[model samples]
Target: MIGRIRGILVEKTPGQALVECSGLGYEVDIPYTTFFHLPDTGQEVTLHTHFAVREDAQSLFGFASRLDRDLFRLLIKVNGVGPKLAAGILSGLDADQFIRCVEARDVNALVKLPGVGKKTAERLLIDMADRIKQLEGQFVPSAGGGSLPEGAVKPVTGSVSDARDEAESALIALGYKPQEAAKAITRVAEEGMSSEDLIRLALRSMIPTK
Candidate 1:
């Protein structure tokens, strides 16, 4: 298992990042939540990573935090979930939010995520509710202010529309139909919203939980 990666960020898109370690460029698949936290191209970035191997293919998935990576591992263990769907779930919500939803039995919020239906949501709640307890020590509040660790670089902000495009592409990559992605984007469209904002708002609008 490739547990971590430290490299220069060569390029980044909504769902992928090209990172060069030594002379080789590694393409790392990442959730949108991780993508949102990426530093600008050409900067040194570090990610907690998981390397998955199958007879047909091999892939590396990266996350901004160890908690996110750990939660992803748990998600893939669900009866009906796989790496892609697990990644999609993390793309829609970070580890903390997802854990909160599971703890609260927020099926409505889970169903709002791309590719998750009611049955899947229920499965996630039942299966993940206990698994999330393992992540308690790793949890970090997203809204709590904190200084960047030494050697960490800040992400660059892009235009609002670019953010929208990024968020829409992420939703579509998570298995949403193009039209559905567009409608969701349109519904939450607002001035000055970053891609992260658009994604969070769009999801909240679609999944109103108790």
Candidate 2:
């Protein structure tokens, strides 16, 4: 099952992280929310994981917490929902935020998530309403608290242009078109904002909560 991993973070992008465990480097697909909490490269980090196996390909998805990982498992079981879409959903909203939206039947918020349309949002509302119950007794990590240890993220060394480019790439990876990603990053672009900061702000601007 590959339930968890604790290793040195080798490299990371918006959609993936390379973790070195023992002598092996495992490439883990992670949502943006999980990416947000990743420590700087060379620091130790841990993630809850779900290993997916198909006839031709295998993948490992990582999450910031067990709750998020469990929620992802339940999400993929929904009709028409797959691992990628589930990752996109978590990229927009972490497990706790997603649960609240589901409980409130907030279709607007759900629809704002990448790759989720109105129909999919409504389906998620009806489908995940009960599925979230499965996570009731499990641990619910505080927002932005897991996957990264304190003091591990240092100021990233890069120019504003580099930060903007990285943020745009991240949004595009989350299913936003190139134009949309560029516009969002432009709107939130500020001096001294690192790539991670720009990405977080750009996502919030695109997916504002009610």
Candidate 3:
């Protein structure tokens, strides 16, 4: 139940971030939507988090907004949905977009999300339409953002190949097959695009709106 973390962002990949707080680095799994909001490698960032525990593992899932985090809590309670799938869903669509889809019964939009098939999409619409009512008035900006740390933080630097490699790795981590990730990256990649841009474009290609 670690609800929030404010610290220096040490590292950020498309699916994860390492935040150093009080001299300890916390590895927090994040969705690409949250990833898009991250400041450079060394800045104060605040993430609304949900701590998950099981017999075998523990994980912290972080979100850029309280609404997204709250929606995530409700999503995990849905039948057959778990934290990983819920994270993937948020990566594709933030909470507002997701709520609209559920309200509109947009199965096509949900199905386009990574790892979600038609049956699962329909399930989300039916299951979440009512459960989402609990999240009213909760959309707020994350705290500790737009501020620098006490000391300077060295930025992470990488080459073009590095960006491609990181983007592919991130997609694979999100449950896409290696082949699929590679193909998607190859299809959208261009010279000088950062890993974030590459990942965003690839996901958009996979989950187009029209």
Candidate 4:
């Protein structure tokens, strides 16, 4: 189990990052929240990671904090929740937000996340409510405090269309049909929105309050 990684960030996208450590470049699957905190390419970065292995493939999922990584491990244990879905959940909402939703029993918020439906939201509320307690001792960055280290490379800005494309791709990755993803993005999108903003808004549009 590769629990953590510290290396030079080589490349990054909305859903993945490449970090070089010990002459080996590791492609780590990451949530958008982690993506938001990534340092510029060629800078040092570290992530708390979980290595997943199956008969056919191996994948590394990483998070900005130990709490998020631990929470991710708990999420995948829920019935019907797999690694991909668990990653999607963290992508849409960070560990802290998700824990708050569960504590508040906010099914509306949970369902709004990509790949989560009523059933999944209910299951998360029921199952994760207790599991989240295990993450209590780990350090959790405060809201909006998950940025890269001081003096690290500044984040690269993208155009509105790039944001839309990223949001659409994220939605598709979470099992939404491409057409559905496109439609949702189009509905809530505005000029100058970031990919994270577009995705957040699009998700809210899809899952309405009861």
lDDT of each: 0.80, 0.83, 0.81, 0.80
C-alpha TM-scores of all predictions: 0.85, 0.88, 0.81, 0.79
- Model 1, 1-210: lDDT tens digits are 999999999998878999999898999999877877898788889998999888999999998878788889999999999888899888777666687688788888888887899999999999988888877655333334632222223455666557788778767777778888889999988888888667767766665644
- Any runs in candidate 4 off by more than 4 Å, and if so which? 139-161, 187-190, 200-210
Report how far residue 124 has shifted in candidate 2, in Å: 0.6
lDDT of 2 by residue, 1-210 (tens): 899999999998888999999999999999888887887789888899999998988999998777788889999999989999999998988676787788888888888787899998999999988878988866434365743222222334444467888888888888889999999999998888888888888888887664
lDDT of 1 at 150: 26
Better model by TM-score: candidate 2 vs candidate 4: 2
Query: Which pairs, if any, clash in model 1?
Result: none
TM-score of candidate 3 to 2 decimals: 0.81
Name the weakest run of 10 consecutive residues (lDDT summed) in model 2: 147-156
Please write out the lDDT profile of model 4 over residues 1-210, one tens digit for every residue.
999999999998778999999999999999876776777789889898999998999999988777778888999999999888899888777666677788889998887776789998999999988888887656434457752222222345455456788889888886678998999999998888888677767765764432
On TM-score, the leading prediction is 2
Best by lDDT: 2
Better of 1 and 4 by TM-score: 1
- Output the lDDT of residue 184, model 4: 93
Candidate 2: Cα lDDT at 161: 60
